[model samples]
Target: MTHKQKPVIGITSGDLNGIGLELIVKTFADARLLDICTPVIFANNKAVNFYRKTISESNFSFFHTREFEKINPKQVTIFNCWEEEVNITPGTLNETGGRYAVTSLEMAINALKEKKIDGLVTAPIHKTNVQSEQFSYTGHTPYLKASFNAKDVVMMMCAENMRVALVTEHVPISEVAKQITAEAILSKLAIIHSSLQQDFGISKPRIAVLGLNPHAGDEGLVGNEEQTIIAPAVKQARNRNILAFGPYSADAFFARGQYEKFDAVLAMYHDQGLIPFKSLAQGEGVNYTAGLEIVRTSPDHGVAFDIAGKGRADGGSFLQAVYTCADIIGQRAEYGEQRANPLRKVSPEVVSRLEDEKIEE
Candidate 1:
């Protein structure tokens, strides 16, 4: 495929019984999406058809094929990963849901590795059900980290107003403090820094670090994590020429609308970042996995078990996930091109003269 061709995005049907397919169907129903990126859903035709019935308004249709060469840019494609007839119980958690979710993900990742898909956009999955011998990780971030052998990956929740990256993801509240080290902070910072530049096209991104305690530890009265751990990490980041600041109180930070001032914010843990991000996102939040070899994005929300087959699942976040995935792919390509043939640094005198020179129309 040429660089000018539309990117092929692999979509994983999360838990079959959940809102995963619902979101996918609703988002792709708008045929205009096919114009930007061709979607290759890694799922069984039966399963997709099952969910398609739930969403009455969905006009989503697809070509059924197992071959990547058969993929059509103008049509949605269902890359059949399995042909077995399985029971799909919407809003119910079962082993079948977990098994098929894993199957869909495995096939999609394989396609991604084989370069059949340009990027990946995953729907939500049940954490407990999707665990076994092959998939033992707590969530997608860790699973993907191990899948690609990445040293580390940052779970960044993105929206229009602000972007938030978590320092510790899916860890217990008790173990959260134990995991907050300077090295971990710096590692996440590096990923977020590079991601901002390459994925989001931010030239000089400003990052804000949130405290691990209330009122930023109140100068050691509430806790010393801000002083000893988070603050020092911020300082170390600054020394590395990263524009990182603060061990600011998380509550005051969002309450005061301080996040709008920076390009991204690095929160200490999952809830610290997500709670505020989801609140501000207005259903358009995208969960992006940074520091990975391949582009992957997902809706910030999880599987809605209660409203799975109700046709009430909002596709805003899922649509944004697709949009963000395609955007980052383009951004990475442009960033790569710029890096390959970067402009030479000019002298200050020459720059001044060029700025002062008048151009003829």
Candidate 2:
């Protein structure tokens, strides 16, 4: 499919005072990236212009639009939030910036739910500054679930050929034990499996499930979650004909490139998956919110408060987010074409898995 035929992605300007605006402004300035997908930014025109001028970016035009139905991808489209003007200072943090940042996200989410756009590409928002009473939940994943009536969601960071999904997210290190359950692991694996097939279009995507304890609990001597919780879940997923197996020692899994054998690796916790993911990915990775009714992705990095307003802030991750969304939209469109052809039929196993998931639900 051509870029124009691809889904229109709604880009959320995360925080006014942070690099969200700067990155969005700089990335969109590149007209060539438009070939991937047309982007609509949920942002303030004045704030965007103010930041662009500060950064000395003059190539892009921010076209303001009140009605989402009037979005034109050929131009830089803006959904007017139009809150009170704030100074576009580089490297500064304020509640005003935070409030405006989240407003953009909320607006974009509404547009996604209404099918105003195909996918959501969010810029980084300062977790501390951009949150308000109306916007609750620790971060975007939870926020997405609450807004869309989704039961469970996964956080997967993607860079090049590598994708990592976290089984336990945002929970404290101390509570990892209590939260680790066979059912939870099984459910997460199922979610990842479905996401890989439907969104990623991976046929029989292989998954490597990470062990909870170090060295897989040193063969159940040091810890037992590996044997007690993780192993059983892996077994159950296998029984369902899902190609999943693990509880591999986290240290060995990433070290030996064991992760390369699978489409995705299920990390036991946040840092367990993210440290390696970011180390390899850095500024180039995109954080994808999996299992949403609409596609959503953001830069893997968070709000760089220390360099909030600095022109030095990198736009690589944000650019990657946009490109990733574009690729997925293209892939989904390809699936549409395949479905249209009467000669190709979906395999029986694929159809059965879909039915089984619905029954489980």
- The candidate that wins on lDDT is 1
Q: Which portions of model 2 miss their true places by more than 4 Å?
A: 1-4, 336-342, 345-361
**In candidate 2, residue 158 scores what lDDT?**
87
Q: State the lDDT of candidate 1 residue by residue for 153-268, as single tens digits.
A: 99999998999999999999999999999999999999999999999999999999999999999999999999998889999999988999998999999999999999999999
Q: What are the lDDT figures for the candidates, one per model?
A: 0.92, 0.82
TM-scores vs. true structure, each candidate: 0.94, 0.91
Instruction: List all candidate RMSDs to the true structure.
Output: 4.0, 5.8
- Determine which window of 10 residues in candidate 2 has minimal summed lDDT: 335-344
Candidate 1: stretches off by over 4 Å? 1-3, 344-361
- How well is each residue in 67-86 modelled by candidate 2, as lDDT tens digits? 97687767778888776766
- TM-score leader: 1
Q: What is the C-alpha local distance difference test score of candidate 1? A: 0.92
